[model samples]
Target: MRGAPTAAALTDRLTAQLRRRPVRAFWTALGLYAAVWWLAAVLTQLNLPLDAVEMLTWGREWQLAYWKHPPLPAWVLDLLYRLGGGSHAVLYLASPLFVALTFWAAWRLAGRILPAPLAALAVLPLVGIVYYGFTSPEFNHNVVQYPFFALLPLLLHRALAGTPASRGVAGRGPAGWSAVGRERDWLLLGLVGGLAVYAKYSTAPLLLAVALLLLCHPAGWRALAKRGPWLALGVFLLVAAPHAVALWTIDFLPLGTPAMRAAQAAGWVERLWYPAWFVAGQLVNCLGALLVLAALALPGRSEAGLGNPRSALGFDRFFVLWMLGLPLAIVLAYSLLAGQELETMWGAPYFALLGLAGLLLLPRAPSRRGLFAALGLAVLLVLAGLAGYLGKNLFEPLTSGRGMRAQFPGPALARALEAEWAQLSGGAPLPTLVGSFWLAGNAAAYGEQRPPVFIEGRPERSPWVDPAALAETGALLLWREDEAGRPPGWLAAWQGSLCPQGELVLAWQSWIELPPVRVAWATYGGRHCDRPPLAAR
Candidate 1:
């Protein structure tokens, strides 16, 4: 039998493996991260996050536009809905998968720009980023943009470096890729860049940044001079053209949302205050990353180039400024100029390339020890986030008798509502509902019928719920229980004939000991509601 390896030998073997196959280690880490977070999220969160639940309400409509955003996110959610056979829990996995894809894109980008082991060193610091960690479980349009943001830069970099006359030039496209391959990269850049905005209109800043890069930067200027940019623009228009159709068909319905006004500058002071507040949130979010950089750069350490990686070169310098800085500058400037108070989460995708940026700050690649230090800090940060997540999500419900939306008793609520609807509708399929996205959405998502919610009872918000269509099909009218358990003024107007109504007090899911959920509900055009099972009161 072979003798057991020495500790030094084992260490060397592991190091060699990481050197040879960092991608494997990268994937293994992501897998573990996803698995742990998924289990924890499932355990702590009985109901979906608000955005996710809201997406479900939108997805069933299969519309090209929702009131708040574009269709790509809804399209993805709709696909997941069908794949899960209507199980909303499947979305719990999407955020993780999207996050992994973002990380993978970053890794791919690093490889294209930097040499191997050094490339692996830079990516480890990303573990410290809050956007990629604590908030990742809640898949939304922001989460969907994760991969798009990372991949777009990667594709653009390849295209810019691969244009004609870039052959054997510094920062040229990866070796062995022919001119055709470079052209293909441009096509992909256009496709992905277009889809980024399709995923969210907020992605326009990045697109604008790309345009500026082409206009001003050397590599980008060269690429623009060739067939690459034209081809890219053509493909971009082709990919994004449908959204224009979607907008026209919808008559620009998003302009009608009150939330649009809500996000705008409320007062003259808000221009300064809003951007400052947003910047502050982003800084706070990136502190974990800062810590990783600090660890990687501790002075007097044996780390190969801990505090000093090689300075970024020609295109790399441009990439940092335009790709990283310009998009953010555009957003802040717009917020300042237009008085639009930006959501801080809009900053999430901007930092996926942070590790690549780190190389520029440090003079040389960090030694393996330094890389490990950064990775270890990341692991600690993730654990801290987990503890915080569980504590907030669980401790409040157990200790203070308060429940977050994550702790909502959705399945229990759905089951009770479904059974009651069956009796009331006499098996008519419980066609639809109108209420708050959270309340009605939970009911529809888990209910066997899976009816679409007409959010806030507005055709503009839920355009699929045309009053004419609903008049033919009929819908359930429901809302959360106010202190007085009263209907809204709109619903109370009673334009349509109604049936008997009742309340549903849903027991908490799993071991959550909080007070049950209470929704005031009624049948507008369904069957039997006289003998209600849910509303004992």
Candidate 2:
């Protein structure tokens, strides 16, 4: 140009300009994510009480399968404890990190379906509203499950985009076959699916959705005909079989006995009411965002530009439905069949998918004024919602039960509890069981040695306990006075001396006799005689 600047000179100029264009954007985003998660971890750690810490300390390895959920999240938390020197701050980082990775993956996937600028802007709103600023340690599956969820869409996109001869695409023949055969893409998909299932059994619904997508689309059929889909199926089965077998063999299969059946029938009222309450809670948790977004991004809506056939028939549309609908379907089906309630955590993956959908709906080439106005409005709404939620629940106690009293005081409490326990035990082995509010268990950041027993009047169904039996080992029971309701009487039989420390009620110095406690009765009728009266024991 202009007498032809030397090729080398032109190249150098372009490279320099590109270099100057804030390459740190990636690092900056990652840094922000890490910083926020670290802060949440610190805050969560500070709020946990000693009882909660005890559960984190001593809950066993295979203790993951239970009536409520699978064990992946607990296992991950255990790993964090080992890596972060037993810091809750470290454990807290997990969700945020997952959220960040999800955003990144979504951005990449959006780029495949949208223009670059639009994709970036679309994700910005989600980052602000759905993830970056929100905090919840109880969102275990959501944290880990989302990253994998995002990845699935990306893989699907690649498989579709690849040439017919590529390894992962569907074959040209049958409706459900893979084009590239089973060795590469199918196996990879299976592995990923398996991992997702392992992370959260809730992910099972998506597998069916994937199958549906393949069957519905020509490209998907092509990929399937080549053995890729079958390989994926096999791998997924292999990965998920052990846990599924374990759940059936150890948990559900055993429940087939007559005693179990009677117990289940007896608790039908609670089983029904609680599940309804759980569903209601989830609706409130989303704050109607799911409904609002559905309205704004409804298919065939000209205003949102989602009606375009190209967009509607593409992989993006399929993924959007899969991500949002699969979880809802699974929860609804499970609730109807098993009488289980849906919790806020169960719906986390849906939020992530919703965020992706939102990004896909954003208009490309918006005028500067329009862009600023739209972003400004989004910012305002998000800030208002966040402020309102925090005002109501974060700072102020929203629930009448244990509420926010369970947060560990971070370094202060950890040091103090360790010191106190060491002195009390006189170097003897510390009792294995500690009890606290559910939130406290999350905050206390339990170590390997002392696990916290959650005493929220639901021990039989508690994540820390065996639904089939009462804890038979010697345990240190910690409880908050306000939260000290019915104590497990079986624990009293083992009768150890009580130690009342600051905000902690420690019970039992020696191994106690585990009375014949009925799991079904305990779960349904409440913890009647399972715990002794505070004074009587």
Cα lDDT of model 2 overall? 0.50
Q: Write the per-residue lDDT of candidate 1 for residues 1-537, one digit (tens) a residue.
A: 999986545545545656777677667777888888778777787788888888888887777667778767667777888898876667777888888888788888777666665666667777778898888888888888888767888888777655443334643455665553378888998899878867877688889988887887666667766798899899999988887788888787764543455477778898899889989998899888888887767653444322234533455655755677888888889889988777888889788878777765775556556556666677789899888878877776676667777778777777888887777667667777888888888888778878878776777788776776664676777777566866566565433455546678877654666666777776654334454333333
The residue-level lDDT of candidate 2 at 130 comes to 41
- Poorly placed runs, candidate 1 (over 4 Å): 1-15, 163-174, 178-181, 255-269, 300-308, 469-472, 493-496, 510-512, 526-537
- Model 2, 1-537: lDDT tens digits are 368776445434433332343224334645764565455445433454332243343333446354445566666767776787766566666666677777777767665555443444445445444433454433454566777767776666655554353223334333554334336655777788887875665566666667777887666777766666777788889988887786774555323432343223236675676457656665665553443444334333132322222342344565666655665666666665666545555566655555557545544333333333444444455556456534433444334322343332333433445555566546544433444344234324543344444444245435455533434333444433222555454435333333323343232111222212111111111122343433442
Using all chains and alpha carbons, the TM-scores for the candidates as numbered come to: 0.89, 0.65
lDDT of each: 0.74, 0.50
**Best model number under TM-score:** 1
State each model's C-alpha RMSD to the native.
3.9, 10.8
Residue 250's lDDT within candidate 2 is 58
Off by over 4 Å in 2: 1-27, 40-45, 49-67, 128-137, 163-183, 253-345, 359-364, 381-394, 397-403, 406-425, 434-475, 480-537
Cα displacement (angstroms), candidate 2, residue 63, comes to: 4.9
